[model samples]
Target: MFFRALLLLLILLCSNCENQKGETSPILQGLLALDYLILSDPDRSSVYFSTTRSASVEIAYEDGAEPNTGNFAVAPTTSVWSVTESNLINAFADRGYTVNVTVPTDLSSMSEFPDQGRSTWTINQLLALVPKYKAEDSNFQSAKFFVVFVKGSLAENSGVIAVTVSGAFGIGAPTVFVFKEIINHFQDNLSPDKVRKAEQMTVTHELGHALGLVNTGIPLSSDHQDTAHGNHCTNTSCGMYWALGDDRVDSFSPGTNPLIFGSECITDIRDYTP
Candidate 1:
């Protein structure tokens, strides 16, 4: 409604300006003042509300685990994806964003995850099963996002554990797809806490993409974006670190190097006024 009013006002002013030629009438001045007020109004523009964002998660689960061990509906917080969500929530909060995460109670089957035993699935292929996060909002200024958890791993040939993709040529619609098999691999290799940290770091790193870190969309504080690393930070300690997660796990035990978000990446998200 506000947008409509703004558009109508603009159209009327444009028509009046056209009809009146160059005559600076009182009515034209009034219209100009109204336009200035509209642009400066907090309720009309996004200047006041850019600080908050809403985010949600959808988990794609396997109906039946081949080993009958893994389940998505169990204590959701115990899920590796939950760890990831928690880290994201904290990161955004630190950046002064209000993050809301909702996990659907019902778990969908592996069919929602992949074609068969092990297959590669695209973002559209997966998002078809569930809708992205949306708001029943009168105010359209809020930032909204959806992060998806695919219950199975990608094809063995595909060396990646997860990928972050944006909608329509990476312009806006932000979503993250995490392969459960990757978390499963970490769970087997690391201790319980370390596994949790690994999951948290994995999701946090991907969430960085959605937040436009490493010069993807968010401007860098420095010329430190590792283009060679593909939208990853050059500093290894940063959450946007580009190295393969599995490779880093073997190398950096909690005793030596901890999983944490880099200050550079955090600053990018926090200070990104756009």
Candidate 2:
């Protein structure tokens, strides 16, 4: 609908501007506008309500930050990847898009800091991994989202369990870094289920940032953005809340009945155009 109508209008305008050719013509201008409309927000363009393009999710972990436990032999079972992958697949499937999630692989030698406690990856260090991944894996460079499970914290925000870097800042697709050690420390490593659930909540919350939630990149249907915390919903029960707690994870299990995004966030996602 709306897109089709816009396309038809552009085509009709092109016909009228046939006599005036070259870059100054209305046709070129209209086409350029269309291109910007589609490409301006790359993540949202591919992830939200996109019928033509499918989405790919790449998972990688540092050498010491492998996302697996001995409790489950099903590879990523009882791991962060298991929960996040299934959540993304189900979310995209609901919107009529196929999502391809790669298995967790090792990202070696990219650690700039010495140890886990003081290891903080700067933006430049994170950007450096982009080319290395693109060189090794063919599908990595083109993925809509890149998730790296690491053992340290973000250079900018050390207290956060995870952080999302926007592709709009020239990183290509949005990249998410889950601080495995921090999550483990925060959860006190009590049990596999508790740690995994905490990790799942963190990853899902960060992925919401990648998808342009809370009026960041994606347009909002209503005024639900939390003015206090940037790019987070005001609803405390929502997964996109500023800070996630054990209660959130305990209440909502992945793949069963996860009300991750509240009504406002869902409205923004479904009502978005280009």
Candidate 3:
């Protein structure tokens, strides 16, 4: 298994995390707190229901859905990501986790330079960018988990689809990164809705990691973890599948309508809050 105890040491350092109830919440202790790097942040990398849910998510999309300077034009709009935003909220809501999710109605934009930032960005670099973005709109200070959708590529060199540094130690902002370049890769072959499905699935999957599934933040209900693939589900078709591939994401398949959580994963979350 790639998920070694020593690797855990390298991925997560939650020094600033505190248990609101004197003990770490299941999500905080096991799942959400993991700090490993993926090809796509949380895509490579939800909300709903109940006020008691401790963590909330806010999704920030670049204003106007900037088209890449590269060949991948026709960026997915904020509405595209909003489909993901709603999907995420309902994913948690069904589990009774009480997570609240928000996406910007007035997304931030960068018309000055269509290529707003580098093709590849490091966590620290993205960190610096988030607050600067918030400076344009201070609402960021309120979100517990902030995901930024920018019109660029990340980990293009590593085959990583995206990146997130949420729950890492010494970090003040808990965040996730999504790149538009990924959308471009699919736009050529998949229908617009299918492409959007891939985008939404990535959003919810990463948030699942942040919510503590498959022994990351919350304890497991069964032995469903694909240890071979780190913290992903054993079922490749499942949303929480550990290793993601360009061609294999189940949500992208036509008629896979009403993207839903896998049964075993929901059992795990239920065990945590029940």
Q: Give lDDT per model, in order.
A: 0.53, 0.63, 0.52
Candidate 1 off by > 4 Å: 1-53, 64-86, 93-118, 122-124, 130-144, 155-157, 186-188, 244-259
Task: Encode model 3's per-residue lDDT on 13-62: one tens digit a residue.
Answer: 44235523476555445544454332112211112122234334555556
- CA RMSD of each candidate after superposition: 9.2, 6.7, 10.2
Q: In terms of TM-score, how similar is model 1 to the real structure?
A: 0.58
Q: For model 2, how many clashes?
A: 0
The positional error of residue 265 in candidate 1, measured at the CA in angstroms, is 0.7
- lDDT (C-alpha) at residue 48 in model 2: 48
Q: Tens-digit lDDT track for model 2 on 140-244?
A: 223456677777777787888888875433225667877888888774444666676677678778887877777766777888889889889998887788987
lDDT head-to-head 1 vs 3, winner: 1
TM-score per prediction, in order, is 0.58, 0.68, 0.60
lDDT head-to-head 1 vs 2, winner: 2
Q: How much is the lDDT of residue 31 in candidate 2?
A: 70
By summed lDDT, the worst window of 10 consecutive residues in model 3 runs over 39-48
Backbone clash count for every predicted candidate, in the order shown: 1, 0, 20
